[model samples]
Target: MTERISDFAAIAGRYALRQPLRIELEETGMNNTTRMIYAGEERYVLRVYDNHRDREIAGTEHAILSELQRADLSFRVPAPVSNRDGATITEAPDGKLAAVFGYIAGQRPSPESGAHVEGLGRAAGELTLALAALNPDARLAPAYKPYYDFENTHAAMNEASVKTLCESSPKLAEQAAKAASLLETRRRLTALTERFKELPQQWIHGDIVFANALADGDAIAGLLDFEFCAVDARAMEPAVVLAEFPGEDDALAMNRMRRFCRGYGSKAGLGADEIRLLPDLMQLRLMDVWLHFAGRLAEGLDPERVWLRETERVSFACGWIDRHRRQLDVLFAAMAERQAAI
Candidate 1:
């Protein structure tokens, strides 16, 4: 607690906020320490990253936000604030890097709302185009491996490690066994890899679940968190978002996904190949999540249930997609046709 208090004091000094500013921890994100800061009439967010320690990566995140602010899209995104030295990333006393973003006052949109889901899609589509334009920067750096780079990405997550971690509990073991079976065949599918090779590559936010976006009524107030920004297949952008659509069965899931795609297609183009590969790409996204959480649990950073929840979600999503492959094809084809018509 003393260390935390000292860090807050240093942050206030460096940011030139009023002395002894009121800072309270925000109990939301899983990977980072987020704090809401109150300075007289102003408010801001202090994000202390837990996933990566590289300042260059953080700088690239800020640069992306800086460029996005210039893009002037229809909605808002987190804006990085510069400290007294005009540096967006502040080195904390304990060596972790931190940055403050202007606070956005809005709530996370409901996934159940068609308008909210559609709006999220439009924002993603707009960002896809904008980020594509903003890429190949000399300062651009990777925050996390792209989802499709399964080998280099999941190499550390070996079966032995996963098995040992699973032994800790029967519930987790079942989730692990389910994940292992589901991922084995899908990850080895040559067509998934080969098809996406022809698609365009560009910078994407890489993580865009609904929690990352703040909504004002039915509209997107701002997009938050770019910690996973990476240069990847352009189509991978929407697939990541689509994987976040939740439902008990294929119809309900597809409804939300189709709405998101309609909104996205209306704003951006999805080629025939891109459209066809979306289902496979979305499965890959789920795979990444399960593997990511598994790795986190193995390293003792996360508990069993945290990983279990995501594994179950991934398990259900993968099966849901497979059972409805024909619908998946029709859905994306429709999305492509709609985009072309527009």
Candidate 2:
């Protein structure tokens, strides 16, 4: 990592940018190495893709942003800066794909701030609406595995390899047990998957956690990171957002969830059926997270301690969602009714 930062001079020239006075590593996000580049009086974000194959994902992201730039949305998004050859991505000496983007100015929201939570909800809603306007294209199709798919969850839960991986941690073991019991019920899972298949499909920002949102005071100034962008179920977008937003308590979390749904309702109204299916979709999102970590553990990439923390968090969230399922149904129903009236 030290060597990569020191070699920024050669890399920066590829994008027609001057040598950086300083290159500070932005040590956030698990997937990529990002750096803040200071070149003379200008600033930009330099992202080094984790794998060479990520170039396709980068190309798709660039296209999505290009389309979004035309929309009159409220929040700003990262715009890809092209190299001298008009290519958005360039290869480094190590065969990794990298790109520079026009810097988006703002900071991530404070975890304890209710106003920031609401702003994030509204920003996600606005982005969803804007993305809806841009017609779906083949480039937006997911290049990686579909983590949110129920069939994927079903397979992962049943795998002996995954079971062996879970045995290493008590939390994962318990989650595995719970998954088995839930699958035994079977009817709900089957119905939920069927309903999910019926929901509208479109290109969505696959990851919309707080870290990807930039806030200025109480408002969302920009939405960053579109590398996970893909064509998927529309409900999955709000489901992911609601799962990620921070809330101090169940009451606060419920309120935040309602606000998010309302914000999304304002632009693209949820169907009554879609409203009814939101809880299941939310549960599915949590399960998706669980499976992702389990996969990481199985691959020997995640530490048992870290995997335990993630598994426990997902397990607790699933239970909480189950307890408040009825309340969420009522809130989403009201939102759908209001949208119908509008």
Q: Give model 2's TM-score versus the native structure.
A: 0.90
Candidate 1's displacement at residue 287, Å, is: 0.3
Model 1 C-alpha RMSD to native: 2.0
* Backbone Cα, N, C clashes tallied per candidate: 0, 0
Q: How well is each residue in 1-342 modelled by candidate 2, as lDDT tens digits?
A: 666765565567787776545677765467877888887788898887874457677888888898888888888998888999999888876778888888888888864677777677677777888887666557665554443464554565455655577676676676676555444433355556756777887778878878888888888899988887776778777788777643348777877777766667776766767778777777677767766676777777878776677766765676677778788778878888878987
The best candidate by lDDT is: 1
Model 2 clash pairs? none
TM-score of each: 0.93, 0.90
lDDT of 2 at 90: 81
Q: In angstroms, how far off is 25's CA in candidate 2?
A: 1.6
**lDDT of residue 9 for candidate 1:** 66
Residue-by-residue lDDT tens digits, candidate 1, 1-342: 978877966775689775447888765597788888888888889888877789988988899998888986988888999999999999888888899988988999888899999999999999988997875657886666666776568778766666677777888767666767665745564346756666888899988878899899989888888877888888988999887774676677889988998889988997877887888888888877777888888888887889888777788888777778898899889988888888
**lDDT of candidate 2 at residue 228, scale 0 to 100:** 76
